[model samples]
Target: MSRTKTRFAFVCQSCGFRSPKWLGRCPGCEEWNTFAEESERVISGGSSARPAVPYPEIEDLSLSRIDSGIGELNRVLGGGIVPGSIILLGGEPGIGKSTLVLQAAEELSRQGLQVLYLAGEESAQQIKIRGDRLGLAGKHLFLASETCLERFLEEAQKIRPNLLVIDSIQTVYTESLDSIAGSISQVRECAARLLRFAKGERVPAFLVGHITKDGALAGPKALEHIVDTVLYFEGERHQNHKIVRAVKNRFGPANELGIFEMTGQGLKEVDSPSQLFLTERAPQAPGSAVVGAIEGSRPMLVEVQALVSQSNYITARRESNGFDRNRLSLLLAMLERRAGLHLLGTDVYVNVAGGLALSEPAVDLAVVAAVVSSFRNQPLSAKTVLFGEVGLAGEIRAVSLAVTRIREALAMGFKSVVLPANNLPLAEGVPKVELVGMSSVLDFMEWAG
Candidate 1:
């Protein structure tokens, strides 16, 4: 009698690690009490395994990149899509990640390039319907609805398209990886295989990935490390505009951004986001002030609105989504202690108009102005624009790239600006905006008063 070969199955619930049966901890990596018993499909007996072949490196001079026909996207991709690159796109659900690539494929295909779009999440009919609605006219664009990795690879080899898109890498699976779809091991294995295929075949692949609840790409930490580029699709759901930011890149500037507005047809480029952010401005409105901030290389003027009201609640609740709340409290304290504004009986509320989460300290001046404007029942002058950093000691501080902010304000037709006293290095030969420099937060309060 011959000894029999056996297969075992196990799963790690904590990290979702699955493997062949019972171990003290997990041989995958030494994590105690992480493994659990799981029922998984096992393969054995009559099977031929092909030896793995290493992908030979292509001569860099021989390979080339093709433009995606979108100027901003080209900038984000470092002047277009490299022939053997693997790019991962991550975003919130229903944020139009799929629609963007679909439109890109349609545009590229119409330009006489062969393209293949593989969607494991959507059916071929569904994609075709969206394409028809988008009014794309091209015989070269192809679509396949498949999720199996082996079949997908085979299909790609047959099609040999100029550009290949997997609607999402999260949906793909490989025979060697026992982990379920979307699991860490599964995503990692699938991505590695796809990367090898893309490199060896000289095919550029675009992967739309699912974002975690924390807004990061969902998968093992290694998954992100495997890709050549990572882009974040960010924006407020209520707003029509979406900002595509490159978080990591090998070929492009890291902070590059592409702005698009979701429309009935598809996403259209927003040439002037400053105009978009301020087009709905309410002139002479108390508690509303314009703030200029830079996102990537683009300068935007967003309005900061605040309302100060009498409140009997002891907590005096401070809340802000796009703007920092702790900073708001410090500003209020400065107003009360140094600037002599009465806030003991008031509730203060602030909002960064357009729902943009502004992180830079540059919004400080506008925030202070909005609060002061509301407290005094006076409207901020429409001709005024502001930027600066506020300090704990009620002192106004210098901010980064001051001249650029002022230049953007002048381009937007704003006549005056209130900024840090120290940040004025004037732009030469340009019609300039009047720069009002202040030394302290108290100075702004006095000015507003």
Candidate 2:
């Protein structure tokens, strides 16, 4: 009997970079003190290689999607969940990741689909308590408290469930690698095995992933590449509403947004997000402007609030929430150079109401309007909405989907729209709204006065 030789190497936890020896800084991810030693058994000799097969025809193959009974979730998933797809849901701790998955599982089970939920961090009793609290009957929802990937797969093979959910990928480990559960090798290997199982069984799987302190998924970067879709929960945990944004999706469009309200029962889908965001907005308030923004295919109305105050120190402070700080600085420079709003001695602050992040350039005009309103202590009309991109030359540029944005503002009861002069022709057919077109930021300042 020959003993197997064990090979050891240091691996970076941030990325799956391997090294022959340990170093203070990782050359792959450029992070310090992130490498951990891992070992694997060295197998000798090679087995007979299998021959490759020809590819099968997939043009005539049509897939039927499974509805999770959640409209917002289905929309984020590109209509419905595709079979054999692996979906990774990541969020900060206590951000309702488990609650959302359990609710979806309960709904699937209610529709006569057997759902096997493997809870790696919690026990069966804990999951049961959560389910009962969520008012789930759990007719066909099977729960298993297991962290070993091999045994869990064995049980899954026997059950042949329609849907599979792993409470978390960080806590599950495979025995083949001599590493801890949350280590890079273990997480990567377990995720790979799960992916193979899902593809072979043609069953859709949901993976709950933990996030790092930097708000990224806690695992090797390759974990995200292995999944078909990635959904992230965004918002403060103390808040009642949460935003689910799809950063990556293979079957559907990316950057899709879903709104949900946390209730005593479970996560409730928000149908009218624009209304919810504007419910508590104060009318006739200075420093506030409404912007018609589009997230994926859904058009929404969001509030952009800005505050301009004299700085106590010699250097002015610039801070922004739910909006890019660099963009704020650029906008401030443009305002000072073009609109003659002397902001060098004042501190500027900007925030997007309802914890919704606005990355689109169409909100530029609204941000500028809000800042001007705050600086001059004047309030714009509450029924007016703005959307257009501002260029470095003080020109208002036309944005995509102008008609869609106008229609959303109209539906939200906004009477007037301030848009780029070029987009007026695109939105000319929209009825019952006053269109105020601006060719440049100077024109906007004239309109504001």
* Number of the top-ranking candidate, with TM-score as the measure: 2
**lDDT per residue, candidate 2, 210-283, as tens digits?**
88537334583558899989998876777899999998998899999989999989899999888988998986
* Top candidate, metric lDDT: 2
lDDT of each candidate versus the true structure: 0.78, 0.88
| Candidate 1 C-alpha lDDT tens digits along 284-345 | 99999999898776688888899998887987766675788998888889789987888878
Given candidate 1, what's the lDDT at residue 217?
37
RMSD for each of the candidates: 5.6, 2.4
